[model samples]
Target: MPVSKRWTVEVLIGEDHGNTSAVARLDTNDGTHLVGAGQARLNPADDDIPAIGDELAAARALSDLGHRLLLTAAADVAAVAEQPVHLTW
Candidate 1:
């Protein structure tokens, strides 16, 4: 069967006291949800750049989400194959 589905990810970022954090939420459309988080800390000696921090945090969060998705897929494959499975990027 040929099928197509749309998945969306929402990223939220916050900064407090020079610490920036981001969260990425994934909606799989199958009632399964996944969340990934990342953080960035500004150095006192360095210039404060909110955009840079947000970029780093968001990138890390998305990376984390991708890894988690891989793990979930691996587990599902293992369940159907009746064996332990390891997925590689």
Candidate 2:
């Protein structure tokens, strides 16, 4: 059987006092409810550059979100195996 589902992700970006910040929120539910929040910031030495800031912020936010998701997965696996998970890759 083939199964599929949809997850929603929202990324918000903003700049304040020479600091560019971004936050990514992901919502997933598969008989289990889980929400993840990822945040990132960039302090540019030069003037305001929207393109560069966006790229940096978005990349960082995604990286953070990925880390959180991996952590959750590891915890789940450890719970089922009754042992801690140590991923090497």
Candidate 3:
């Protein structure tokens, strides 16, 4: 049997007080949802670059989302196998 499912991710950003923040939302067809957020700030001495902040915050949020998904999967596997599992990543 073959099964196909789709997942969607949305990233929202905000800027205020010389800081940029982003949130990434993950929606899975299996009814699992996850949210992650990250923030970046401009140093007083560093050049102000909105794009840099956007990229850093977005990447951090996405990375957090990925880690969470992996942890969930690991837990599911442990439940089925009837064994305690520890994830290190």
Candidate 4:
């Protein structure tokens, strides 16, 4: 079996002198339907605020997508395993 499903990821960041927020969205390959969105925020109090915000946002988005993929793969594997198979000698 082949998986015809594909996804795309996009990230947007907003920042002030000390505050930052980032939103990551995942859509279908066509970029029409949204599959998931992840958000992250950073305070100026943190070290390397901009970089930290970006890293957190990217990590959240990637983690979200990775979790989805893992679940889907597990379900497919389980389904295939449940199917009856016959062998002839």
| TM-scores for the candidates | 0.93, 0.75, 0.89, 0.50
Best model number under TM-score: 1
Candidate 2 residue 10 C-alpha distance from true site, Å: 1.0
Quote the RMSD, in angstroms, for model 1: 2.1
Q: Which 10-residue window in model 2 sums to the lowest lDDT? A: 32-41
Each candidate structure's count of clashing pairs: 0, 0, 0, 0
lDDT per residue for candidate 1 within 15-85, as digits (tens), equals: 99889999999997797799999999999999999999999999999999999999999999999999999
Error of 4 at 17 (Å): 9.2
Ranking by TM-score: 1, 3, 2, 4
How do the residues 10-81 of candidate 2 rate in per-residue lDDT, one tens digit apiece? 878887665667777777666533443333344455666666777677778877777777888888899999
Which residue runs does candidate 4 get wrong by more than 4 Å? Answer: 1-36, 83-89
Q: Write the per-residue lDDT of candidate 4 for residues 3-84, one digit (tens) a residue.
A: 8987767777666664555555667765443333345665445666577766766676667666665565566676889964
TM-score of 3: 0.89
Q: Say what the RMSD of model 4 is.
A: 8.3
Output candidate 3 Cα RMSD: 2.3
TM-score of 4: 0.50
**Lowest summed-lDDT stretch of 10 residues in model 1?**
1-10
Instruction: Compose the digit string of candidate 3's lDDT tens values, residues 1-89.
Output: 67698789999999886799999999998899998888899999998989999999999899898899889988998999899888788
In candidate 3 the C-alpha lDDT for residue 77 amounts to 88
Candidates 1 and 2 compared by lDDT, better number: 1
